[model samples]
Target: MSDRFELFLTCPKGLEGLLIEEAVGLGLEEAREHTSAVRGMADMETAYRLCLWSRLANRVLLVLKRFPMKDAEDLYHGVLDIEWAEHMVSDGSLAVEFSGHGSGIDNTHFGALKVKDAIVDKLRTPTGERPSIDKINPDLRIHLRLDRGEAILSLDLSGHSLHQRGYRLQQGAAPLKENLAAAILIRAGWPRIAAEGGALSDPMCGVGTFLVEGAMIAADMAPNLNRELWGFTTWLGHVPALWKKLHTEATERAAIGMNKPPLWIRGYEADPRLIQPARNNIERAGLSHWIKVYQGEVGTFEPRPDQNQKGLVICNPPYGERLGDEASLLYLYQNLGERLRQACMGWEAAVFTGAPDLGKRMGIRSHKQYSFWNGALPCKLLLIKVNPDQFVTGERRTPEQRQAEREQAAYDQAPAEPQERQYNKNGNPIKPAPAPVVEQARLSEGGQMFANRLQKNLKLLGKWAKREGVDCYRVYDADMPEYSMAIDLYHDWVHVQEYVAPKSIDPEKASARMFDALAAIPQALNIDKSRVVVKRRERQSGTKQYERQSAQGKFTEVSEGGVKLLVNLTDYLDTGLFLDHRPMRMRIQKEAAGKRFLNLYCYTATASVHAAKGGARSTTSVDLSKTYLDWARRNFSLNGFSDKNRLEQGDVMAWLEASRDEFDMIFIDPPTFSNSKRMEGIFDVQRDHVQLLDLAMARLAPGGVLYFSNNFRKFVLEDNLSERYAVEEISDKTIDPDFARNAKIHRAWKITAR
Candidate 1:
């Protein structure tokens, strides 16, 4: 304890320089800054002070040892060399955080486990007691770093990241980290402006992070005055009196700071839910008397007209990072720029945004740009002087121009005399050439947003499909929840299905979005409008799925895996082919060669077709729907499959129980629930799956395989069935590229006879 130890202070990246300045000001010697971190030598007193008073630091780590490690063996021995008893008892709970890779340590979890084992083994031999691992609310937190064949071990002195500040009970979406907010204010020179009696404002404050941090800085209060826990609280090394002195000093300084602040500090937010938390954070920080937060939009924001103000205005606007994020937020940034330009004509404004291009959309040129990192996203802070001479608001058109525009509009609207049409020489009345059709009124904003999402998903799934030779694929799922539709592509044709929207959404808005989305789909996929057929997909009962929506009886032949099948876009609720099950079909094709195949509840017999094409000795397809059975026959004939492929029109359960035929391989994928009049009784997959599997197992030969599949999201198998045979769930392998995003699209299992 007599030696001066090295202390490493970690902050968010791009704040290291600020932290370095902070450490130097705290009287810590040999201060140096690195990317996202800083280190300096300090005694116990200075270290305690940093934990209590420093606002920019995330963690204060005390170096214990550094050693060269050649392998996992070296790592174990290196940790074992230290006497952990000096820090924590054998029965205490602790947690180890490990980072970096070397010396046969590629997985961080495995590395942490090894470190835990070494410590446990070392302690248990002497005391006969092992320390338990506590991930949450641990008594001690140990940090381990393995870098380039070397390791640095440290004890976390602050316990949790110091940025927590202990005031935020709740936060809005994408709240800024507290310490990062403080660092930003420092970089924006808020403290200097406050010292000169300038106002501070956060127009887009969420959860009051910037406002609270700004008040703390302005009032000269320590950041950790309210923190009740520290890493050294439970350690065996006790220097309680020195720590008590530092905390007492910090508490007195905060009490004095709280009585002096009545500065013009405020925040504004649009969400009503965020208002209370902002107030709550201010109250917890003991700054409620000095700061006020209200609910309002940026468009109506302006400084108090009565008070002449020269201060700093800061905002962290949402930086759109998703496919449709930028399009929706263009007006938000533009409004921010206009608000600054027209209102605060003499103040300084700072905008922190991750999307720099959107910053340009503000129409106000920034005088200064400083680059900073918000977590991993690179961002910029734009500094501008709010003066009309420097940045103009670019307000609406002049009165003269408006008057001229109205006169021109009146002239264009007047009726005109009819003109005679000219014919080539026949003198017959000729009509003007047919007007060219305008590209279906460019998709609405909401529609373009849906199309953008579809295009993004297509670029990702299309590449995966090409690598796997998958032709029929899903191009768009319920990506935008508002649209609530699924679009699939089969060769050159597209099939669309709209999921019923919730009643809460306005019917008109929902209808408009659907219309725009439909109009936009053809353009997004580069297909003719006639090639897309739209339908409503929802829960069906009994014969609802079989009920024909249109009597067109239109059917087209689509080839999947070189096997042709008939698909009716207008006749039924579903296409004859289930595209998601393509991989399962290919599975049957790959493994059914030289094997007998049986497909139960087979709609259109796609699996039977694949099995027969793979050279199966015999294939039998059983289903209750005579319509699909006849369609199955057409699919068989189209693929040159005839004699060996038997299409039986009967209930699969009755067929399984009545027929004594044994098959080497069988595929069964039942509907989630069915109660058709043709069937003997209702079949619920979750309720009758056990009975279904038992019947199929009875008809299987010794060492035979049965593949049971279902789209029932809540399906659960009989656990005792595992005792009867070797059962393996191959659901992951059954999903194709298009349905990968939706893992619950379908589930498949492979069961084998013992």
Candidate 2:
């Protein structure tokens, strides 16, 4: 064993530079940065200190040996060459982790097993007292990395990862790892702010990761000081005295720091579920005195510190992954900016987001920016000094006004005398002045045009909707060529589907127009921006079309033709109830009295519910998705028509072929193209319509009516089907007024035995 050794400090991607600086400062000599690791020289004490104090490192590894390897035999012999007894006992448990792939070791698991076998063979006693494998709580954790054609074996000096920190046993769905959060704080200059005794706040803190990390940095506390277990805890070369000296120094420093007046640190989270968890985490960090958390939303967040105190307003709002999520996330970033401008005029702000384009929509100028990787996603840290100079005004200022602002901004940069404290009758300091009332966001010129068109459509359709007691209808259907979208109103909620622009048009221009439409929607419709759900409508084939857009299981109940049906606005591309099919459903209800009704490819069974309400004798609905079948059951339960209405989940074609029952009325609305794995073969409505019709017609009673409908715009009915059965095109009769503007929305027909 040597006093000095080479150490490799691994961290999340994009933190390598920061890690190198931190590691060098912590006594790591000759620290050099790699992609996600830093190679450095350190003594035993320096290695221990690095493990205890390094915030930006995920693991600290002490390289034992680096050997050339050509195959697995070389790997095994290389591991067997190391003195295993010097690290762990023969009967102790150990874990081996192998990474990279080369030199005939293509599989990491097999390489790890080979390494483990070599160690076990070397440490085996005469009575077969060999070291056992323990994945968790192992006495020794060995890491073997095959780089290029070389094997680098190291002893893990940091148990688990340094990011565990022991405080966050509970976290939100997407909690930032502790080391990453610390790296963000460092990049945002939180250390300098804390040294200056400035306050800190997070508007959207989830489980208070930022708050705890910031408090630790401010209080000069080691992040992993509270951790009870380490990879070296039970190793043969533990060196308790050396570790104790460094640990004692860290404890003493933390005690001295905590003796000072606690900094004003606060966290506000929109989710009430995470409020208590955040408080608990802060408590576990021994930072309860310095940090406080509250259940608050971004729209109403106001950090009430003493009047003159100003610090960083940091947050990491969600960056949606789907294309349609940008429309809603844009408003969120805008609201965050509004809060900063209105409430914290003199404060600095740092917004970490993956969506830099949405960050640009915040209506504030960031003076500096830093690039980071949150896991594998590249993100940006927008550093803003919130002041009048940084504000972005929608209205253009004159040359004189701009000159005056520049002079004022220069003056504002200088320090001013602290304001006199104001107190109330009860002896508490009076609240700070109310935040400035932010003006409603103004629409661009194109946005105003889109809004005007929407208002005109609403005015015309509003009366019709009110007259007919319609709560859901299409308000806009690509009326303007520039704004190619279909907007529908489900009660007060708006669902906007942007049609994919053709490649002939500039993608940038198309995106701009879509943003303009989204910005115009809330104001033009007089609704909250949060109530709108947007999705891109494109040509989807196979199973992609049936996939859920989101996982929010929330469903809203909407009314149609005096029946209640559930609509999930955010979860699926299609809201359960189709507004265009309102007239067809009504027609079914009108003619379903005393008839046995059947619906094929019944999505959510809206029509079956209508037939049940129409006094049908019995109704049967079949579809391939159990999700839809369950939803149909809920619809039946909602309308109190559970009995005598059967819901089936299977391939519609197979079910139709096996059915022997006759129905007085049948409705078939098949998808344009479906290749669901549950089915034996692909189904193209145009190619297989004849077979589907024949199978369904076999179950149709004499003198029965069968209605078929599809939305394939280019679909043409075969002339031979009319020869076999009497067929009439009832497409015009099935379309409602809302779909009159686009009569090609769907085609329908009625067939009867000849």
Candidate 3:
């Protein structure tokens, strides 16, 4: 009898149809969509083929056994009943993963442990030895899923998530997940669209996921073609010869039909940081020749004269999640809409937005909306009909069109001048006259010379600070040409101000001399005695002085009265402590009076010290580097805190999941864009914020507050969160003097009662 195997392919929700299509394309006859999953019957050979080619699937699992499970014990026994000896070597490494449903197995880890125990116990009893568990890189991955009192045990054939397509050598701030990108493309009808030679464009394509996925679809290439490994390849039952044959067949098919270049697939992003990643991803996907990526703003994107084929534009623009400000996003969307209406005649456009409210500002009605998940947060893909010939070409006039026409007619009908209006004494109409331009005297050469002298003095002060081993120091004399400002940094404390210099010479000269004298004080006071490191601040162009008069330095010390730190106020406008975290601090102080606290990305440990002072029993801080953690410790010590605080130098997400201790209060403030060498993956505030929140919230005390904040100016709170927890924007209280009222450095929220 031919071997019959149950195969399941899991993907991000709403992409089941695409997965089914891919299965069919692979010659699987009975593919069907299930909730957030796809199930089908396939021979072992077909399973291998699907594993090698499917793009949108997160994992491909081969069912080994199925039985009615009454409880955890039933689950363990059901997993043991599988013919493990036939599919996995007794000595091979294995990892057990579980997804729980209604079997009273609410804890997935506990369920996974039960299954692991059963498998190991069964193997040891029969073979005298059992397979060891290897979480990092397992040889045989066992999946245990319980739903509706039934246990489904399967062998994970894809191993790691398929989204890690190996082609992305680099990434930008909040890159779209490869699988999610593929799903979006499939939902946009890429297979049919590509077959029709329809062009695709992503005007705001960051790192070119959409463009790469589009090119791959057009080229008929298997998503796993570039992947280095698959979970099935290591399975004991996998047939190497059959896998090789399937791979060869897929490659041959791709080569046979992918000879033509894709129909004008293009991507444009204004940020230079995204350019390199886009280039790298496109090249790694082998689509460099077929796809074109450029560094340009979405507002200015225009199709080339020769490549003006009307097609589809799919954009995943900044949804005010990572970018900031709803008002600013409206302007961007308005400009984008106008550009699309004017340039993309006969083309369709779709935008993926986490914020539906922002969708209203697009000034266009969506013909369709598809609900999908962008990394766990529910989002909508809005489809807009741009420049529809039936309406825009004047074949039909919708109500909106008629209203616009009427407004234009009314403007044209207004009288140019009223007959009863009298002329002014200057022979002009009585209406207000245009304001006259005012001219100011240009800077005299002496004044310019004085400014230059002041700058020289500041530079000298910087040099003096460095020479004196000052960890943080500012360069300024109150008498300089620019406003006199004091720059101070003892540790993480950065203070800047106009210096009131002691009067000894002409005001300007004395100011300049005061900076010179201040430069001498660092050495005289024996500051920066270690001479460990020194940095200089760069001045801004066109301005007579530094764009900022603040000090630019590092975290050198922390004190109770005030933390002393280095800052770069002039060169970069900020030294990092967005005062808005103050409210979060107050919240921590209130809750931390005697409980453990966990701070992720604990920069300067300002919050940690606050928690410690608030009488936190203890504190555990996790950050990517020891440098920042040490600074945090110093901040604690500076505040008369103690060594009782524990510090972990690693990725916060991974550390939190592995941590056994729960915290009463947790503060998570990740960088807007961080590419840490020590991290396993890139961290993006917009894309990973929700996942981070979930991770941190999981570790919170039953009544604890998970204070989460990000500096992404356009950050939009995930909407689906309302059902899970109470969220309120406490941004107003977090603001401080250092940050301007208009400058939205960060947004904070209190998450509790989940």
> lDDT winner among the candidates?
2
What's the best-to-worst order under lDDT? 2, 1, 3
lDDT of 1 by residue, 1-754 (tens): 4468788898888888889999888867899887788989999889988988788999999888899998888888888888888888889888899989978999999888878888887777464788998886677788888878998888888988999899888887788999988988887889888989889888788789999999999888889888888888887774799998988887887778777746789898755557888899889888899889986556557755345877988989877532123433555677677777767767888888898888887767778888888888999988877775565344434789678668756754555433433222222333445533435658778878887888888878866765455556898888778888989987668899988778888989888888989988887877678889999987665557777788887777666666666788878888889888888999999888777889999998999988877867678999998778767765664554432266788988888889998899999989888888888889888889888899999988887899989987778898999998889999999987678778899899999977
> Which regions in candidate 1 have their CA more than 4 angstroms from the true location?
125-127, 321-324, 392-754
* Candidate achieving higher lDDT, 1 or 2: 2
Q: Indicate the TM-score of model 2.
A: 0.57
Give lDDT: candidate 1, residue 103: 88
Cα-based TM-score, every candidate: 0.53, 0.57, 0.54
lDDT of 3 by residue, 1-754 (tens): 2387888889887778778887888767678898779988999888887777778788989888789987777887787776677777777788998897667788888998999988887677454778899997898888978878888888899989888888887886667888888877777777787888888888888888888888887887888876667787677787888888888888987786568755788887755456777898888888888888876555457754343576778988666555434433655666576667667767778788888777766666778788887877788988777755423335357799789778756755655654343333223334333433323223444444544554565466544433333334333323434434444444433344443443553677745544443443333333332431222323322212212333444333322212232223333344434344655665676678767788898865777766766767678888876645554544543343323356678888788778777888888877776666778787777878888887887888888777788767767888878688888777776653323323365788878865
Model 2 pairs whose backbones collide: none
For candidate 2, write residues 1-754 as lDDT tens digits.
9999999999999999899999999999988888899999999999999999999999999999999999999999999999989999999999999999999999999999999999999999999999999998899999999999999999999979999999998998777999999998998889999999888999888899999999999989999898889999998988999999999999999999899999999998755568889999998999999999986556557975977998888888878632123433655677687788788978888999998887887788999998999988999999998887787854236789888778766655555542433222222333345533433478999999999999998878876775565778999999999999999998778999999999999999999999999999888887688889999989877556567989998877677767767788887778888788888899999999888899999998999989887877778999999888777866764554432267778998899888899999999989999988899899999999999999989999999999999988999998899889999999999877778889989999999999
Residue pairs clashing, model 1: none
Total colliding residue pairs, candidate 2: 0
Model 1 TM-score (2 dp): 0.53
Candidates arranged by TM-score, highest first: 2, 3, 1
Clashes of each: 0, 0, 35
Give the per-residue Cα lDDT of candidate 3 at 675: 64
